[model samples]
Structures are given as C-alpha cells and as structure tokens.
Target: MSQALARLPGLGPRSARRAVLYLMKKRENALRPLLSALQTVAEKLSTCSICGNVDTSDPCSICTDPRRDEKSLCVVEEVSDLWALDRSRLFPGRYHVLGGRLSALDGVRPEDLTIDQLVRRVSAGGIDEVVLAMNATLEGQTTAHYVAERLEGFPIRLSQLAHGLPVGGELDYLDEGTLAQALRARRPIA
Candidate 1:
C-alpha cells in the first residue's frame, strides 16, 4: 500500500509510509470510506465521448448541459486544465481536451492527441470561437500552433490564453519569457 501510494504524484516513499501508518491507525474512519469511495469511482467513472472529460456518464455533465454556450469552445491540453478553468466559472462555453501536448522529445504528435476530433467538431458548425488554453511550455505552444493551423479556414475565431504575470505575482520573480510575453500582449487600460 505504501509503495502504491508512493507511485502517486507528489508522494514520496516516506510520506506514503506515514500515510499508510495513519490509515492503518484509522482504518474504520479513513480507510473504509476511502476504499468505498475508490470502488464507487472505479465502477462509475467514464470518459466523455465528445469532450474527453471524465465523469460518471459517457457525455459528461458539461457536455450535456443545456445552459452551456455551444458557440464557444475551450481547448485544453488535459482534463485537469478544463476542470481548473471551469471551477473559475468565467467561461460559459464547452470544452475539448487534447489529452496531451505536442512534445517531440516525448514522441507526442498531432495524431496522438484529439486534434482530428476537434477539427470535426468545428467543421460541424455552430462554434464561433476556440480558445486554445494550453500551458506556456514549448510543447503546449507547439500543440496550440498546430491545432490553429488545422483549424484554419473554419470560420471560427482561434484564440489563445494570454501569457503574462499572475494575478498576485511579483514581476521581479518572473522569468524572461513571461516578461517578454507580458510586454508583447500589453493592452491599453479601459
């Protein structure tokens, strides 16, 4: 159990061991509930066929929601990114998960992602905007560029997430690339 916990992200062997010991001590309160929850999730969890979001249903709650804006789509590199954006309740549109970014070193290619599915979704009409909410990494940028190229001439506005300083960030602590992007994307204050 410790080894399995250690294999999870951000959990070291020592931490996993401590967690196992704690769970052992609180088996009735923690372990049983955790095991039951895990079993339920394993039994009911499924991937959304349209957007690739994981949920209890095949289409996912977001995809099936009638109140969601169908004319706007937010394309993200992973389901986690989609969840993060949705939790903010800012974008009222649907989403498309690319599964991963384009990384030549990691052998991730356009074909490996759901780019074709995205193109098909756009080609089907009603989508007016596609927000490429990829990460600032090189692979993410490459994937965004590639997807933009694929989505060319689709009569949809292709946009990207602005790369700049964070909400409460100190400029002095930022990297050169972020500063450059912030400068390039500078806008007149309204």
Candidate 2:
C-alpha cells in the first residue's frame, strides 16, 4: 500500500505510509471513493486532440465552444500551466498545451512537443494573437522564444505573461503587492 501510494508525485515513503493508514482507517467513505474516482478518471480521461488538454472529448470543450475567441490562442508549456492561467481568470482566448518545454539536456526537442501542431493551427487561419504563458525558467523562455520565432511571418501578435513574481512559483516567495505591480508594469518582449 505504501509503495502504491508513493508512486504519486510529492508522496514519499513516510507520507505514503501515513496516507495509506489514513485511507485504511476510512475505508468505506474515503478509500472507496478515492479508488472509484481513480478508476473513473483512468477510464474516461483522454488528451484533447486539438490542444493537448486533458478531456473526455477529442477537441475538448474550449475548442468546441463557439463563444471562445478563436483568433487568440494562449500557448502554455504544460497542462498545469494552463490550469494555473485558468485559475488567474484573466484570459478568454483558446489554449495550446505544449506538453513540455525544449530541453536539449533532457532530450526534449521541438518535435517532441506540439510545436508542429501549433504552427499548423496558426497557418490554417483565424489566429490573430498568441500569448505565451510559459514558465520563467530558462527552458520555458527558450521554448517561448522558439515559438515566437516560428510564428514571425504569420500575421499574429505574440505576447508572454508578465514576469516578476507569482503566487505559486519560486517567485511566489515575494510579497503580494510586488507581484501585482510586476503584472501591471509588464512589457512586451523585444
């Protein structure tokens, strides 16, 4: 049980053991529901074909929603980043999940990600703005720049999230008002 629980991210041996014990103590109410939820997700969850977001459907609700701005697409390094941006509640455009960032050391290349699909989506038409919401990490910035360069000739406005501090990342260690000021004073990437 500990081994099984430890397989989850952020759960070590000690934490897993504690979690397993807790679940065992609440077998009927907590454990059963947890197992059922896991099984349901395993059976129903699938990657969205158009944007690579997790969904039960292929194109996903965002892609199929007629109210979403088709002309604006926000490119994110991962589905987690997409979720974070969604939590911010500032964006109303569609999203493109890249899966991962470019990292030569890690053998993650441009082809390994959904770069080609993004280019195809933009080239196909209707896209006017692309907001790169990649992390502030080196690999994230590299990937963002690469995408911006690839879309240079296309008639689209490319932008990025304001950099300074955040509520979650390492920058989150900073004060709240500082992060807000950084967001307000964000500049366009040259």
Clashes of each: 0, 0
lDDT of 2 by residue, 1-190 (tens): 8998899999999999999999999999999999999998999989999999887777888889888888999999888888888787678989999999999999999999999999999999989999998887799999999999988899888888777655565654786766776878887899
Off by over 4 Å in 2: 165-190
What TM value does model 1 have? 0.95
TM-score (C-alpha) between model 2 and the true structure: 0.85
* lDDT score, candidate 2, position 99: 95
Model 2 / residue 71 / CA error / Å: 0.7
lDDT of each: 0.94, 0.89
List CA RMSD, all candidates.
1.2, 4.6
Best-fitting candidate, scored by TM-score: 1
Error of 2 at 12 (Å): 0.5
lDDT of 1 by residue, 68-133 (tens): 999999999999999999998878999999999999899988899999999999999999999999
Q: What 10-residue stretch in candidate 1 is worst by lDDT?
A: 162-171
Q: What is the TM-score of each candidate against the true structure?
A: 0.95, 0.85
Model 1: lDDT of residue 106 = 90
